[model samples]
Target: MNIAELKEDLISYSKTIGIDKIGFTTASTFDGLRNRLVKQQELNYQSGFEEPDIEKRVNPSLLLDRPQSIISIALAYPTKMSKRVTSKKGERRGIFCRASWGEDYHYVLKDRLNKLEAYLQEKVPDVQLKSMVDTGELSDRAVAERAGIGWSGKNCSIITPEFGSYVYLGETITNIPFETDEPMEDRCGSCNKCIDACPTGALVQGGQLDAKRCIAFLTQTKGFLAEEFRVELGNRIYGCDTCQTVCPENKGKDFHFHKEMEPEPEVVKPLLKPILHLSNREFKDKFGSLSGSWRGKKPIQRNAIIALAHFKDETAIEDLTILLTSDPRPVIRGTAAWSLGKIGGDGAKTALQHAIDMEQDEEVRVEITKGLQLIEE
Candidate 1:
């Protein structure tokens, strides 16, 4: 079988099945990425959500027997919402990052990978293949870089020239020998837009990231946000896109190529007050389909309270009071107490004062004390 011909046919089939970009590379060890991961670990900068084994993450040969080549695919998601939610006066909203705006990209990418896998299987009767999406052992960014799909940008994202960084990446490691594409040159040059725009200065320098300080990483944690980074979160509930949004390569690079990748205006940017009151089932029914909802509703709710505080939303004072006084989760109650103090309404101050006396949890009590302090100042 001619490997070159098979590669050509696969590329053609990829377009018919909605894969925006595809590339191939030898299944070699990722030396640079391995070193970077070690350094990131030493600095305690990793998000802790990554595959823990550095060997599995950087060495494709370890994942599949006789791994000869890896095929990387990129599906571009829309950066701009085609539809807009009509927000009323005094109505505040919290935003999920663009990556989570659409259907859970994991499913979308996996479906495409399945199709590619099937195609390869039919062509090579005994094809040994392993496909992976975001949660896979291998770093999708590193695979995409080696596969020539895009260059690793300063913000630590794969920046494709055609789609910018708003692309979902997936990969298939195969035993079949295939021709590889040359990797793209780094176009970022000396431009520091993404690094300069990071809200928490998470982009420490160029390609390095301090995930501990990254708002994108912080918003996903299912616990009380440290007071230091709470203000940096702004209206973000799920992930941060500041670095990508500010990139010169991403300028006006919105693409609605795939229908499944389209953002529903209300879902991506939901009303802050409604989010604070969502029952677990209601939250699941509304947000279960989106990737941002994976961490469940607690984190989103906590962030919503902070976003309300960011706006000093007098209207949400009632809801914040309810959360502060009776919410089961200490994080929610504590955050509500903090938000009430930040908003500073007459009733909000009253609620905080009452919470100080009734709250049993020491952490919640501390938040209540802080809220009272804000009211005093």
Candidate 2:
């Protein structure tokens, strides 16, 4: 079999199917990422969402038998919403980060990879192959970087020159020994913009991230957000984009390449107050299709309450009061108590007084006291 001809044919076929960028690399062990992940584990910096087995994550051979090559694909997502959401007075909205804007990227990228897999199977009969997206054991960014899809940016995203960092990544492992592509050069030299712009200083320094301090990671946690970081959560409901937005490389880099990646203005930036009352069914119906809903509605609703406080939206007081006074979940009740303090007013104080009187959870009571203290301050 002519390997060069096969690779050329594969690359040609990829663009026909809407793959924004594609690259190939040998399935050698990822030496650098193994060390970094181990160090991250040692430092207690991992987000806990990562696959626990380090060996399976770093070595493609562990994932696929006799893995000879890996293919990395990137699909560009839009940065700018074509239809702008009208901002009205009093009703505040919470923003989802760019990555979670559209139909869950997992399905979109998987659809693309499935097509590529079928094409490869037809080309090389009995070809051994495996594919994975973000939820899989492999680090999408690491695979993309080593496969020449893009460079590892300071924000920890693969920044392709053609598509910037606003791209969803996926990979396929195969036994075919295709020619590998050269990795891109790191372009963030002396560009301290992303590091300086992290809301919680989560990007500790350069390319390293303290995931516990990251707003994106924080937004996904089911527990009560820490007071210090809750103040830093700003208006982000699902994820944080401060680092990516501040990066110079991403300037003028919006690409609406795929319809699946297009953001619905109202859906991605929904009103903060309305989210506070969504039933499980309602939340699933509205946001289930997006990537942000992976952790379910609790984290999103909790973040939305914090976002309402960021806006100091008095309009949400009634909704926040309901959650604090009667919500079944302690995390919801506690977070509502905190938002009440941040959005202090006569109504907020009344709600806090009511919560303090009837709250049963010890943690919820403490949050209620903190809320009252904020109002007094």
Candidate 1 lDDT score relative to the true structure = 0.92
Whole-model lDDT values for every prediction: 0.92, 0.92
lDDT of 1 at 232: 87
Model 1 root mean square deviation, Cα atoms:
0.9
lDDT agreement of model 2 with the native? 0.92
lDDT of candidate 2 over 1-28, digit per residue (tens):
8999999999999999999889999999
Candidate 2 Cα outliers beyond 4 Å, as residue runs = none
lDDT accuracy of residue 212 in candidate 1 = 88
TM-score, per-candidate, Cα-based: 0.98, 0.98
lDDT of 1 by residue, 1-377 (tens): 99999999999999999999999999999999899999999999999999999999999889999899999999999988877876555888889999997789999999999999999999998999999998999999999998899999999999998999989999999998899999999999999988888888899999999998999889989888888898888888899989999898899998889888889888999998999999999999999999999999999999999999888889998998988878899999999999999989689989988888888999999899988888889
